[model samples]
Target: MQDEPTPIELTKAVADFLRSDITPLITGHQAFKLRVAVNILDLVTRQLTQEEGSDASEVERLRALLGMDGSVTELNRALAERIAKGEVDLATPGLAEHLWATTMDKLAVDQPSYASYRRELSRGE
Candidate 1:
């Protein structure tokens, strides 16, 4: 890994700079596009910071729920196949909790500001 300012820090700084300084001088369609760019940068920063931990947690949950081991994508495909065959359902222990946790993690990265996401976070759920 490199030293000093990490990728997450650099990306976040860029987003903050655009949102604070460059945003004020733009108008109309270009301003809207600039906002989109800043939002994308913000999203990238979140993913850069959170993706590894979230993915590891998801993979662990998948392994325990499925009783097998594989890459996260492979494990997810196995889970889908089992569900499709009626082998696993909401009644399965830990299934609902795992799914909910995964969804919350995704929303945390993708839309932490979303109303329901915010509400769930407030509830410590």
Candidate 2:
């Protein structure tokens, strides 16, 4: 009897399928999917930065973008909550600056809210 594929192999196969076939099949949905993906990516990018040190201006800016009128602590708590709830997924490509910036540009027109938030956070205000 043939052995079944391992979990890792299965995951890789699924990823291959998504990129090679499934994604192309839904080209019409690319714009919308890209927007959602970028939004989630931006949120994770900001969260990763917080680990380096406290960026007060960034915290305030994220709060404004999220429409949360609260102190930095409250904002952090809310972000943590959102992450825990699966409202944000951090596994997308380009966790670093360059590629992520490109992805943001590609998707920004459709994801204005994310773009706005990224602008605000980057401004250090």
Best by lDDT: 1
Query: Residue by residue across 24-118, what tens digits does model 1's lDDT show?
Result: 99999999999999989988999999999999999999999999999989998999999999999999999999988999999988999999988
Model 2, residue 64: displacement in angstroms?
4.3
Candidate 1 matches the true fold with a TM-score of 0.92
Worst 10 residues of 2 by lDDT: 92-101
lDDT of 2: 0.52
lDDT of each: 0.93, 0.52
What is the C-alpha local distance difference test score of candidate 1? 0.93
Model 2: per-residue Cα lDDT over 23-115, one tens digit each: 545656785685455455544444443433344554555555456777656876775676678764455222233224434443433344665
Which portions of model 2 miss their true places by more than 4 Å?
1-55, 91-125
Task: Record all residue pairs in model 1 with backbone atoms less than 3 Å apart, i.e. clashing.
Answer: none
